[model samples]
Target: MVPVTRITIQDVAREAGVSVATVDRVLNRRAGVRSDTVKRVEAAADKLAYQPDRLAARLARARDYRFCFVLPTGTNTFMQSLHSEVEATAARLTAERIRISVRLVDVFDGLALAEELERLGEDFDGVAVVALDHPAVREAINGLADAGVKVVTLVSDAPGSKRVHYVGIDNTAAGRTAAMLLGRFVGPRKGKVGLIAGSLALRDHVERQFGFEQVMAREFPQLEVLPVREGRDDFEKVETVTAALLAETPDLVGIYNVGAGNRGIVAALEATERSGEVIFLAHDLTPFTRKHLVRGTIDAIVNQDPGHQARSAARVLLSACEDTPIVPDQERIRIDVFLRDNIP
Candidate 1:
């Protein structure tokens, strides 16, 4: 187990190569500090896992804070797990004087998400979302921020927006990790690799695909990546597209699903008599994926812990609402990789 250390202003100053006074100025949200210096201070604070000593500092004063979480409504196990975490964490957060509510929208409807964000108004102090990257959605997020709403993007991000923070893993790095595993597993076998996703409209999916392609081109140039199949996170669509791809590319030796709907992919894979011939990689660990892993059908699973994400998002939003600085290390979510031998 990692030991927890309480970070102080001095620690942050030393980490940032600055003085305690400079750290104080930045922490106090004071003026006259250069933007670069402020960033360095903030980065150091995060790296040091600095949280205000609530027991000793007067900043611990708390009041009722209203917050909302916007998630997609779907049969996807990952989304369900995320929602459950939000619900489960709510009671604990309520004890801290933070009231939480969850709102579900159409799985891929950006317009619906925009309307939800716009409708929130001043009724809620902060909002966290499993974002869908769209112009209207970005506009809605910015509009809320303009109205003094603390916005935090969860799982996915709305780039070019003034959202207070993004609470998720670096998708590009996750993709690169997936590619590295896939390349090594495929060995010297030169064959086409199938890529499937919910939608490129989602920044996470696009970034993952981009990273996968970049690594593949650089390290596994011999392996060809087939045209991406957009399954829209629907089991029927994913299954159909995956089956069709298998039919078209007899030389397909690997597949990477960057989004949900792993069940569909698994069904299609099971229909074939290839055994371990095709290597499968996907995001998220659920009952369905776990079963595939135990059977040795799916070669590897790349997952994000929704429970940690939900809790982190809440902490960040609460801090934003209370004018408290966040511990960057605490808010950083990790990507978990699993193999058949390491299913736990």
Candidate 2:
């Protein structure tokens, strides 16, 4: 975990090898501060990567930037990790005069999510939402932008909106990668491939499905893609759906779960005594997925760094609030492909 980061005068003073008073005087442009001391203090602050907002804290009304993370309410292990990372990032940034809060919403429900986004309006300086690509949700995000609030889409993107930035992996690329891996893994086997997701309403899932089909149609025509099923990333729902899929299609040779609930799929496979018979590819390398990968129950896992996404979302929102230039490379989230040999 990242340590609590507070760039106060004391930190600058220590870095500058000067007393607190000297550093404070230098920062405040007060008299009695020597030129060399001012130079040292400025250098130390720069080296510490301190934000100008720290100086703004001296005013009668200090600037406290508040950011909101609108995440989904689910038991998905990946979502759980993302929620924890958000909280950790919030704690690490609290000392820097940043206020971050996470709000749980049914991201699968377009209207409900839109209502929540609309309710958040101008209350927060910036908002990072796990946005669904729905007209209502996009309208709500634009509403926030029109109200002078910065909006960023997190995890899943709501395109064609007034959002200033997006923080997550390239879903289309991830999907294509999954398709190639699964296709090659089940090489020469002519059978049906089942696609599962939390919700098709999510732009990420839809893009993944699209990309997967594109590759399958071009390179892996031997495999037939079944109509996708939505499990809401629920274990029970996924288990029931998987059982149905497996029962209905005895020739189910491959499955690509673009969302969570890998455990349910694995359990269903185990119960049906088809654990090692079918090729399974999943998203997010959580403990369960990691174990399954190592045990050869799961062929591959596509993952995005939850911690990096959380930190990037915060940094992007802060930059937007300050009108500062954002470093694209610093905020770009990488998609990781983990197999059994490279479980780490």
Candidate 3:
């Protein structure tokens, strides 16, 4: 076994160019420190991979924590899965004195999400959000952090915000993986390709699209990508868009739905009798996606485990509450690729 070396306050102080006293004050939640100095100390602690002993902290003082999970209210399979995982996590953590409440919001509305974040008030000690990359939402996160509430971004992220951590897979790598799978499955890559996404405004969707395009340009030069359609995770909207795309591109070889709404794509393909003709790739392996995968309607489903993400996010928040250290790699959510032959 590798010998472990505990990170000390002096190390954080050195990294932040501050005194050990300043680091101790920041870690202990003591006052008499500038805001910038506090950020520096926290950043240094994060960079140094500092982990406090949670067991000792618990023994010293036990406290009940109120954590709020802000989720998008929808029938979308992935959202439903995330919701279930959050509920289950709440139950699992209850004996530890963690109270979790799942709050639903209109996922597509950034203004509404911002308003909801602001309205949370002092009801919860910490908040975990499936964030939209919007300025208003970022402002809300900053406001929450300012109020001494621990915040974590779940699944999606507000990249430049003050959120403590982002619990999700590397979406760009996921997109690239999808592109490689699509390019190889479609025997001759010399046909028009199409891409569908909820919105390019979301960081995950944008990163996935960027990674997909990069791989397609580098490895599959013969395939041409068409302008992406904003499916908005709506079945009817995606169905309409897919139908239009099919009508327009006679030789479309493959299509990757980078966001939600695979149900709509399946519906359109089934109706058009083109399910077997074109290679389809999507994210999330839900019951709908599973059935379609088994039927060979979707060639691959790039997946992230909702339960794993929920558990990791909760653990991270709980650790933060006690000023404990977290293992970075342990919190990483996996990217799973599923096919008809390998449906797990």
Candidate 4:
């Protein structure tokens, strides 16, 4: 086991090049410390991740640590489950002197997401966001970190940001796995494969598609991956897209839904009476998808547990506040592949 290094006021004093008395005064908000010295002490404390003694001779203490979750607003079952997980996690952690609030935003809009993060500011000690791969979002995340608010990218991530941690599976690997599954399922057949996504702006979806195409180009040269369609995770939109694809491309033998709107895909296939004709694969293992998997509508599902992500994000925020060491293995989210025979 790795050792846990406990941070103390002496360590902060040494890092700040000051005496223990100065560190104490800075922490307690005493009037004797100079402004520059106080800033140095605070910076050292933050760098060392110093956790103050909140329960020192106090009967009850206010919840001074606040965390926020910024989730995408949509009807995707997986996103809905993630939102519920955060709410349940918040309810369970009420007595721990921590407050968690969730905000819904349009994750596909880079400007809107950037504005939301900019508004968060110092109101939240930590923020967990399902970020888009946008320059504006990255800048906003950096601004939050500069203001002493820890940021964690959840589910989807923003590249080149100052996020303290990421709480999700390896999306690239998941996408490559999806391609392998589809290629093998359509073994030795030469046909086109269709792809559907909520939005290419999402880092997770982009990475997934990249990995899928990489694998297909390298290993499965026999199959051709067609241009992807953005359905925005809406059932009706996905249905229309799928129906159009079926009508336009008769050689489509496989499909991989990298995002949500599973019901829409099913509706399109069933309406066209092509239910068992194509190799259909998707992400997320919910009640609706599980049923389809059992009924042979969906060949396989590459899934990530939303419960694991929600708990890990919350625990990571709490650890940042408490200056505790994190177990990387415990916090690692697994990429699960589920089939009809292995639904459990």
Q: How well does candidate 1 score on lDDT at residue 288?
A: 88
Give candidate 1's error at residue 136 in angstroms.
0.5
Q: What's each prediction's TM-score?
A: 0.83, 0.84, 0.84, 0.84
Worst 10-residue lDDT window, candidate 1? 54-63
Candidate 3: regions farther than 4 A off = 1-63
lDDT by residue (57-171, candidate 2, tens digit) is 5243456788899999978899889999999999998777788998999898899999999988767999999999899999999999999999999999988999999999999
Best by lDDT: 4
What is the lDDT, from 0 to 100, of the residue 226 in candidate 2?
99
Error of 1 at 168 (Å): 0.8
Q: Write the per-residue lDDT of candidate 4 for residues 170-234, one digit (tens) a residue.
A: 99999999999999999988999999999999989999999999999999998999999999998
Instruction: Sort the predicted structures by lDDT, highest score first.
Output: 4, 2, 3, 1
**Candidate 3, residues 137-181: lDDT per residue as tens digits?**
999999998888889998888989998999999999999999999
Report clashes for each candidate as comma-separated counts.
0, 0, 2, 0
lDDT of prediction 2: 0.90
Winner by TM-score between candidate 3 and candidate 2: 3
Per-residue lDDT value at 290 in model 2? 90
